[model samples]
Every structure is written in structure tokens, then in C-alpha cells.
Target: MEKLFKQVAIVVDQDDALVKNLENLVSLTREWQSSFHLIYVVERPAFSFKNIWKGYANGRTQPFDTAEHRLKEYQEKLKKLLPEGTRIHCYCKEGKPLWLIRNYIHENQIDLLLLLQSGSRFKRQPIRFSQLVGKINCPMIMVPLHKKDYDFKNIVLPISHELPLKKIMIASFLAGKKNDARIHLLALQEQDAKRQRTENPYLFKTYQLIRDNTTLTVECHPVDGDNLAAPTLEYARKVNADLILVKPGSETSPPGIFHRLLSKFNFSSSGIPVMTI
Candidate 1:
């Protein structure tokens, strides 16, 4: 069978910690038999002498020779971190970091993009990142610097009353592959059981579909509150989940406090990664 994330790409920089953490993510992705591609974009200073020497130097505009040499050095350093027999490629591009990454995702049909969320140093502006999150068509997995090991024993997929059934099925199919992994289908509801039964028909349909689609064990439950992230985190801690998969809302109404809180919580503060579909 084909791997889940066949073409995975990771963005790296000079930060040793970010590089090391991203290496761990690549290791985990490889464990799932996914083809990996690592790209290190060197952000060069715009005012460098190479840019100044522009048209006068044989139509050369930048210090590409030096950049290429530096890129090779980074490739060698990264190569030492990977397991043997894993095929990896490196690319060195010059531009704004996030913009470059967004373009690369479009040009190459990258299945999943892994990014290291550096603390204050590389703090992504909420508005800007939110815009990219909306525009990017594929799934993006954000891995904080601390979360390295991917122990897939427990995973939680937060579903509201309005989620599509096909999305849930896709998540179930992934969870079923890992031995002993439990898939928790959480429904955060403000109404009682009888009210949910009358109001949310899709929820029932999703429950039935999960049961019929895969042999993987799944637990369906509801939380009696409007705060989706709170209950989702509680369930994750109780189950000791290695990852939490969530679906972002539409562009007009992007993921709110519930979604952002998951990434901001103490559980995700460490090594646990969150996958947003």
C-alpha cells in the first residue's frame, strides 16, 4: 500500500535546535515509510556586496557561488542525522522565509509540510500565518522545537456537529494503521443527549460510518461545553495521545480560540505535534 505522506518536505535554518527537532520529525515521517525532502533556504542579507556589484559583474546579481557552497555544508550536516538508506534532497533558495515556503508547496505537489515553530525569535505573526494557512491547499503539520519523538499510541480527532464524514473517515484510516493506537472521536456539545439526537444527524451518520469503515477501535463521546479545545486537551492527556488531528474552518471564519489554544496548550508546548487538515 502507498504511504500516507509520500512526499514530505521540511524547512530548516541555521538554528541547531530547530534543525535537530525537525530531524526528529523527519525520522518519524520515515518510520511511516514516507518519501522525505529537506529544503534549507539561506536568507542572505539584501545589502551584501554581491547585490551591490549587480550588472557590473557579468550579469551576476548575488553571491550564489558562496550560497551553493554553504548549502552543501548544511546538506552534509543534515545527512548525518538521517537513518541509512533514506533518500533525501536539499534545496537552497533566497527570499523571505514564509513566502518561499508557500511558493514551493504550490510548485511541487508536496503532500505535507513540516515547520519548526521557534519561540520569540521566529514568532509568526498571527494575521500573516493565518492568511497562509487559508491559502495553502495541502495539510500543514506544525512541530514546536521541543516535540521530537512521535509515539503514536493515542490520537484524538476533534469533531463538531458540522464536520464532514469523509474527513473523519480519512483520519480513522490513518489511526488504524498503528498497532494499539486508539482513535477518539470527540464531539463538543452544549445540548443534552436527546437534543443532540434531534439536532445533529450528521454526527450519528459519522459514528456509524467509522464503525463500518475500519477495524480500528474508536471511542465516541461528547463534552458538555462550548469550549472545544479544553475538552479535546483533557481527552488527549487522559489517553496520552502522541498527536491531535483537527480540521480548520473556512477562510471567512478561520479556526478560533479552540484551534489556537490546542497549539498554545502545555501538552503541545512540549514535543507532541498537532496536524491541521
Candidate 2:
């Protein structure tokens, strides 16, 4: 990993679904030695009677009482779950969840942002996540809420034109480098049958780059499909991959087909975790 993710931030949604999977996030930070912060946002009440409200002796109000108590419970549980001596800080905010998260990231200069795909706050549905995917300044990894545990023994990496190589290799390392994982590279080939017969030479180089760097058992598969996402997901299932690591377009570049598909994607429906850098 060229740039160490020394600081990580996880946005716990209103449901706290992702907070339940805190172990998975902690395990990711072990290698990087990143200290993470757990952040929860309480949406501002639809209507507030701030002017007429009489605060308690301590100045705590009734509307925010439940939110404060819930956050305290989460903080206690998370502190117990984290490794010994690991620095962890928890915060609760009141505002739009998305904006609060963005502001927090900018203020803290977080190196990585971890999020969960399952939650009730997503009234805007996939578009909400798509907004984050399109605009997050730091690398973000979103894990779908699933009943199963993560093995991370096999990772399926899809390679397309202008793939984000640096971010991807870093993510693969963090997700599975120590697990002795095998990175299966599924190259998205053009649909035209006569256009190409051989694998892209860059695949070998990428394999070499990852393998040499991490000693990971990197392999490649040529997938001929109309689009990258569908076949990539299929091949990922075929390999029984633990995670599908992708690199969304950078802020400077236009949104790619992958990013476009991700905007409308319901990751939980796929039953696999998708980590993007």
C-alpha cells in the first residue's frame, strides 16, 4: 500500500446495521494500523419546537434524548469489540445523514470511509449511495449486510478499460493480502467475436504487479459480455469470491459504466460485498 490508511472513518446509518459488523471493519484496519471513528447521524426532527421547549436542568432536550442514549450504547459495544489499545472515537450528529458524513470526512481528512449497504434511512434508495460513490473525496468501501461471515480467501477483481489500478491493488491487499487470497482477474472483453481472440497483455502485467507486491495467487479469466458488471458478478459467484473489489472513476474523470451501474445497484440483493477505491 503506497499510502497508508492511517485514519479511517465508518458512517453508521440510523439502523446501525453496519455497526453490528464492526469486526469486519476492524479486521481491515489491523494491517494498516488505522484508528477508526464510528459516526452516527440523527436526522433533525421534521419540526422542532425549539422556542417553546423548556430544557431539563442539564440542558438536554427530550427529542435528542433517545438518539444520545442509542449512540452511547453503540459506543460501549464497539469499544468492547475493537482490539486492545486500538484508538476509537464515536460521534453523534444531527442533520441530513449524507451531508453530515461528507462534512465529517472533509473536516477530519479521513483516509478511508467504510459504509454498509443495508439500512432503512435510504428512502432515496440507491441514488443516495450513488451520490457518495460519485463524490467521496477519500477511498470508500461498502460492505453489504449479510448473514454470513467474511473469509476473504478469494477476491474477484474485474478489469475494464481505464481501470483504477492503484486504488484496486491497495484495496485487495487490505481485504485479503494476509489471508493468502487469490485475486481472480476477470477481464471484460468486447462483445464482437472477431475483434479479439487473445487476452490483453496488460492483464499479465497487472497480475505481476499484484502478485509481486503481495505474493497473492493472482489469476485471470477472459469474460466476453455485452457489459462488465453482469458477467463480472456471475464470474464472482462462480469463484465463490468473498469480495468484489472495484475502482470507481476518480473525481477528475467522467463517470464510467461501472459507476453508472453502481448508482442503481442494490448490493444486498447480490449477497456479496463490493469494495470500491
* lDDT for each candidate structure: 0.60, 0.64
The TM-score that candidate 1 achieves is 0.72
Q: List runs of model 2 lying over 4 Å from the truth.
A: 1-3, 16-20, 23-31, 45-62, 119-128, 175-179, 191-198, 249-263
Residue 180 accuracy (lDDT) in model 2: 70
The sequence of per-residue lDDT tens digits that candidate 2 reaches over residues 1-277 is 5546777887764455656766665665556667778777655544546532532222222345666777677667767867677777777777667787888888888888877666543332212446686576787766665435566777877776654576555646555545576788877555346775666566667777776667677788876644566666677777777877766542112257655565346443466776666
Model 1 lDDT, residue 136, Cα: 70
In model 2, state the lDDT of residue 162.
55
lDDT score of model 1? 0.60
lDDT of 1 by residue, 1-277 (tens): 3466767787665444654464566556655555566665544446767765642253222355665665566566556766676666666686666677778877877888776665544343211334455457677766766765665557687776565564565466456466676777777545555665232455566667777866667777766665466677677777777777766542112257665644454433534566666
> Which pairs clash in the backbone of model 1?
147-271
Error at 102, model 1, angstroms: 1.5
